[model samples]
Target chain A: MKQQRDSIPELVWNGNISVEIHQKENSLTYLANLPRHSYFAQILEDLKRLFAPKVALEECWLSSGKASIKWHWPVGVLYDLLSQEDPESATSVPVLWHLVFHVGSFPSSLVVPMGSMETFRTCFFNALKESDYVRNGSSSLVIALSKPETDTYWNSLLNHDFYDYRPIATKLFTSKSRIIPLKIYLGADAPIVQSSASLGYTLGQVLHKQLPRLFPSAVMYSLLKPVLHGIVLPSTVSTDIMNRDFCYPDGFLHIVLIPIST
Target chain B: MASSINAVEDQLSKTLESLQTEEKSSSLQEKIDEIISSYNEKENRKVNLRFKAIGRTPLLRKNVFAINASHRFDKVIRFLKKELGFKPDSSLLLYVNYCFAPAPDEIIGNLYDNFSVDGYLLIYYCVNVAFG
Candidate 1:
């Protein structure tokens, strides 16, 4: 018999998203259920095979409508962040996320060049250091990771192996850290909100402090809903649990806030 | 300019939606206008920034400046590159509190709010020859 209880990380890792990449001329459409916790860069090696056979991977980019996809964000977070654009169809249904693939041209001004493993690696670690700084007042913990250990950590994420990654990552997480690193996106066009929160503060408390008028109550989400890894999180979830289980591989909780429809 | 306006519009809509659920008041429109004005004021707010050089990069001649809150972190990078007189290809990485380099798109207002020290965002930077 299968194990009755799987860890939260495992369950989150197992969550997959139905994706449809629309290539030029619609001749090379790539469709699959991608891992929610994985980065688009992680699967690009295989996904690129379906289209852009002639172009270099480094030249390829993805866009939804007009916004260039930030490759560093967890694919799940991107889905949650983008889902707000069509809130009517976002509930209880597996929506095939449609993305446009562009090769050789990207918004160089807005985002750094991506598609190389090393580029993604650097971006991921840079974000990792940012989180460490918020937690420990410095990134010494992340900087101290040995070369071999760093490679292992990167490989764990690239391979989508959460179990292999957790033990190594546990060092960076501390209950005494200055604040829970959060990239809370209010909307597609809104400026992303990053706020400092004490270790003891619940998710609700943090939201209330960051956007007090909209999130008036610390115990309840009245005007907006917090979606993490595609699940609508109850306001009572503490920072500790969010940090431990729900933090994206880059070491931040990516919360997408959508207005609650009456 | 456009992104900040879009953000303000988004905030207004969300806040207005929330207010609709509140017990109806005679001055609801006034309340909405006040909230919108507050958001606009916030968008126009300025953030204090202090630059400290690490071991690799040289210390800046002038360390402190007031930056518009609506700008993104890349503007700071461009300012540093111009101030330091580094070539386009020269390597420079910036960190907050000497900790980590933020992504280019991170909004200036958010960075100041979360990581600023004594009302200033303590930015540390260095040439990447010593580090990545």
Candidate 2:
């Protein structure tokens, strides 16, 4: 049995290889690199099992227990396609990136979709509960909002009153100004309401524009499980846009902002 | 070709007869006109909406205001700017309920129908990051 198992190649994450795995103790490791192999399609099939509800999840990059958003290449493009706020006119990707986790070490750099940030953070916290760090009860997760360069440029443009006829300047500036920090207690028994802010128009725009581009990592994959099963809104608001069905008749969506500190 | 022309003539005469016989009583015509006018009035109806501030949203001198239902959402935005004396350069964000910032072109009545409560379409307006 050991010989037969040893004959099966261990999965390794070499950017040029497809379908590599390494078994370490009870943990199964998969690599992110693929080289135009047919198994790439098979790997994507396995990934679909982990997506949140209604995510296209057509294709993605998986490595070290982290999953990036679905991307496509058109003809001559070399880089993976990222989700855009404006898909119709979005020729370029946003400064923020998409990455979801299942369970592993936290990456140094990552970005969640605007509307989905709270859910991703909550899921990340839950995933941490299964890790050694939380069992020791010595750590907590922080969500911090930093104004990236793009945000600064947009805010500055609004501050300048660049468009006199339209209130785009003020709307963008006010809504995109700062990040509300959310501190999550690891392994808590109940959901935390760190802070709640009424969502504004510009933030809605940000959500509509950027929400689609989010790709949940493996650590956060639980949020998408209910979604994938066609449960429109899970019982938990901490997962996604709860009460999505009730949004239309009410003509508005009620969002409880989940705070994060990075 | 001649037969086709004859067919055309017959069709024309039928149309003429139909038109001539289509006249209704003057009272009926008046009622129809009234109905049409009422529909137009409904389309152009003025709506009164109540705006509320949540979190650190600035307070308005008068919270209730009447505006044309036919007006686009942008009109309310402009009205807000005027009421608040916000410089054209400053930023403002509006949301229906507490959740979404609607498109500027969305009609007021549509919003009122979907989200209005207690005779008010609860609008949460903010100066954006000012609250943060």
Candidate 3:
């Protein structure tokens, strides 16, 4: 008797991004008394310098057992940074830093599937291609040349006289892990709600809304939930949350939130 | 008294001789030969038998063996060894339902009797190797 074969493996991403800003002089006064504030302020300054005057900076936090943040500066800013001839600009250049942050006691010897790498490369290149400014410039021509041949293409892009992109610095920090728990913290000026039911209901609204938009063919709730919950969150976030506990049978890494304390 | 005993013994010996002659008249070997010849003729007219092996393992087994005809057995074996750490000395077992058979050493011209699926040749190996 013949048996049915299994489905192909799929790669997924999960994470979130947020942006905040403060007046430079006021931030300096506040940072002088508070060390933590100063640290975060320096990070914001460094990000502003890299992204430059016209670029928007977004905060992204990713947790896949391990949490990490990656700040992708705008292509125009990167183009400017690379082309600057000033000595001060060269001196102020940040180190090309790449660190894989591991948190929550997850193992370090985790294996990431080759398929996931391909998926990431495709998504990243596609995103770059879609940028209008990038597509119109001489840099765009270089990017086009670097499109999807091999690792050599990426290496060449790095060495090209167009952009200075580097991986983010990451460090592991411990915090109380949340299960499927939903907590609503309202701001002081908000109106008192007659029902708290509506508050918790919208917690997953963004995820639910983005699911179909991100993956149009995701029809079944069962299939959608696992893939969405696993890949969507960590990839979107600025932090790199590399989970080492699970492996998908289809040869991909599994990223799922377990009930830590519920 | 002597004349009476001799007459009785002579009648018993004649009865035994008649039974032996009757048994020899029937021929059982001729009937068996005729049945075997007819069965052989029917099989020869209907079905064709073929055999295939990879790395000294016959293809017909309980496991669904994926086989490729586009490449030689040596090339396939070399690829497997290079990519998947499969050794030449690994035992290959083939079985189909309750029937089981192993490939012999001299398999160069053994009917080329295997099916191919999706450009892969499937053979049951006694040694466990990862398959994609």
Candidate 4:
């Protein structure tokens, strides 16, 4: 049991998303494995150095096809949201995320700005504050975090240090929260479905509550399944366990709904 | 193929529109139907929302809006922005209960069911990030 529990963090924290960022003007391609929990802004400084004289860090943004990647969401959430796969397809190879790095024409309406560390910190904290509120019914705990605690917490997420983030999160979470902070992504065109559910609820209960029509009660088998941390969850999976063990550093469970093979 | 992305969106919009169309005409059959239904749908009807301004956000002269139960929370945010004459670039945050901005896409009906009191979904709004 100890080994099983230990593997959860080891698997989640070390999970790398293989990213391929291509330059449009020249065919120069930059390939690297991005940490699933790190935001694009956290890694942009290093990426900008590769093309420093040509493109500044503040001027850079990544896109998949025409969709403007929301920089504030964790890189893994972006991958789950923007990409789709045929479950029946025979190939078992992992997905290599393709992104285009552009220097100009930042679409302010579509995506928020994250050019500076301050902007990134503010956005991250704002999201964290909201998630904490959903879990604890107040943002006081997050606001009360000391300067060093705040820095360590933020750096742990950016650095993908699950061990460093664990204790601080434990201090904040304190107990099994009544309401689980959760965001459900349906599709690209559809806006995200962010609804709070109780800690006692199972995956099936939450699904049926938020999306009853899609996950019809009359149907014996669900036509749709929820994916978290790049793995599909069983209907009986406990929301509390998932929240404690697999939730993102921001304290919210990011779930993606995809069609299951009938 | 039967359940494409558009299928779900269409169902959601139709449910919202149907609730709005028959908002006031809550027939006995509808009440019975809700009771008999296997799933506990929040309400097969609309919600009465009252907006309260906070932290320099302008108060709405006509604060109450009968929002459909199926509409997402983003609609409320967009409506507040347009009514308040906020520029497209401006930021407006909405909160419920006490001091947390629920995600913009939260369904209005769910918020009403979970947090409403006295049959009014009292939403608090701010022109800036006031809570944190």
- Using DockQ, give the best candidate's number: 1
> What overall lDDT goes with each candidate model?
0.75, 0.34, 0.24, 0.70
Query: Candidate 3 residues A150-177, lDDT tens each?
Result: 3443442333311121110000011121
Off by over 4 Å in 1: A1-5, A44-50, A53-58, A85-91, A175-178, B1-41, B56-59
Query: Where in model 3 is the C-alpha error above 4 Å?
Result: A1-153, A156-261, B1-79, B82-132
Chain A TM-scores for all candidates read 0.90, 0.16, 0.20, 0.90
lDDT of 4 at A194: 60
For candidate 1, the iRMS in Å is 6.5
lDDT of 2 at A74: 11
Per-residue CA lDDT of candidate 2, range A13-63, in tens? 011222344323524444454421112223443444444224443223333
Error of 2 at B68 (Å): 1.0
- Against the true structure, what is model 2's DockQ? 0.01
lDDT of 4 at B20: 47
Runs of candidate 4 exceeding 4 Å displacement = A1-5, A48-59, A86-90, A174-176, A217-221, B1-132
Per-model root-mean-square deviation over C-alphas: 5.0, 24.3, 33.3, 8.5
Question: lDDT, candidate 2, residue A71?
Answer: 19
lDDT per residue (tens digit) for residues A158-223 in model 4: 777877888898777645467777787755544455667787777887777666655655223244
- Model 4 achieves a DockQ score of 0.14
What is each candidate's DockQ, to 2 decimals?
Answer: 0.34, 0.01, 0.01, 0.14
TM-score (chain B only), all candidates: 0.69, 0.65, 0.24, 0.65
Name the best candidate (by TM-score): 1
Per-residue lDDT of candidate 3, residues B1-132 (tens digit): 112212322442343344346555433332222322332232221112223333543343332333432222343344433334446545333321112121121121111222212322233333332121
